[model samples]
Target: MPELPEVETTRVGISPHIQGQTLHQVVVRDARLRWPVPTDLAANVEGKPLRRVVRRGKYLLFEFDHGAIIGHLGMTGSMRIVNHEEPPAYHDHVDLVFSGVTLRYRDPRRFGCILWQENPVMAHVLLASLGPEPLSDEFDVAHLLRACKGKKQAIKSLIMDGKQVVGVGNIYANEALFMAGIHPHRQAGRISAERLDRLVVCCKQVLSAAIKQGGTTLRDFVDSEGKPGYFKQQLQVYGRAGQACVTCDQHLTESRLGQRSTVYCKRCQR
Candidate 1:
């Protein structure tokens, strides 16, 4: 699935081409996505100019005059900019046609969504309860400590919870925890305030780095320009379970937490 970095990457990549451009048309090759593409999508957006593309967590908001189009790049979904005359291929499900180019959406698994919402797009149920963005000032040490209060969930799981802090997906969580020297299975409430503070800084650092590198392309992730991310090559503990730790010489360990694969260096992370 495309996480925060991936989603942000797509937003930035496509914004240059579509921002301030008039929407020429809305073409829906398949309306059967995670949810049905809004039946009146064209009526709402076809003639309006796209004001901007903003990202909240993993969802992208295509802002216009009266409303916004909410899009999610689910497990196998991606958006790319193609010439207006380019032919649609298999899995290419939707297109927001513009004067010069088309923003095409493709989803092999159809788990993504394209929906229309009126003003105050954030109030939609899908986004109403989401936590702060990991890179924002709202997701600081103090905020995390409060969420951790009296919680017995594993620190990794707590951080991964959308209601606690959005966009700390499994991969970034592992990397951030390793950077902070916190074990993935540690109790959230049992962690020291100082350590949690460091964890907050590390999470921001890791996420910023991933976004700078165009996100980690474990699989099925590409920028709006169709280029794969290069961050995976720099991973320390997320996928190198049996490999040597980058910090300590000890071998990294792998386990399943919340049913997601977790890799850590036991010697480096307490």
Candidate 2:
């Protein structure tokens, strides 16, 4: 699935192209996705002029005069800018045609989403309960410490929790934990506030840098320009199990935490 960085990259890549364009129409080649693409999506958005584009959590919000459109690029989903009349590819499930350009949404795995909202988007149920954006003021070390209090969950899983902090997915989680020198399996509540502070900083830095680099492409994901993210080349431990640690020269170990593969240097992390 596309994480926050990938989604943010897409938002940045496609925004300038689609921002001021009016929604001429919606073309739904397939409404069956992770959730149904609303049959009335076109009718709801046809004449709405796009006011702005923004991102929250992993979703993109295309602000319109009266409402907004929210989109998610799931495991194999992406959006591209093209001529409004471009023929739909096999997986091009939807399009928002503008005067001269169209934004095409494609999802080979059919797990993405295209939804409509006629009210404040953040209040929508899907986004209402989400935690603070990791890069926002509300997500500092103090906030993270509060969220981790008394939790027995693995620190990895705790940070991955959307209600605790949005967008710390598996890959970035591994990188952040490795940078913070914390074992992914460490009990969330037992971590020192000082160490947790390091984690908070690493999470923000890793995520911000990944977004700037267009996200670490782990197969399926690409920028709106169809370019793969370059951050994967800089990975320290996510997929380097059984390899030598970059920091300590110790052998990196692989284990499972919260049912996801985890890689860390036991000598470097506690």
Q: Which predicted model would earn the best lDDT?
A: 1
Clashing pairs in 2: none
Candidate 2 lDDT score at position 265? 93
Candidate 1's C-alpha runs over 4 A off are none
lDDT of each: 0.94, 0.90
User: C-alpha displacement of 116 in model 2, angstroms?
Assistant: 0.8
Q: What is the lDDT of residue 186 in candidate 2?
A: 90
lDDT of 1 by residue, 1-270 (tens): 789999999999999999999998999999999999999999999889999999999999999988899999999999999998889999999999999999999999999999999988888999999999899899988999999999899999999999989989999999999999999999999999999999999999999999999998988999998999999988989889899999888999999999999999888888
Error at 59, model 2, angstroms = 0.7
**TM per candidate:** 0.98, 0.97
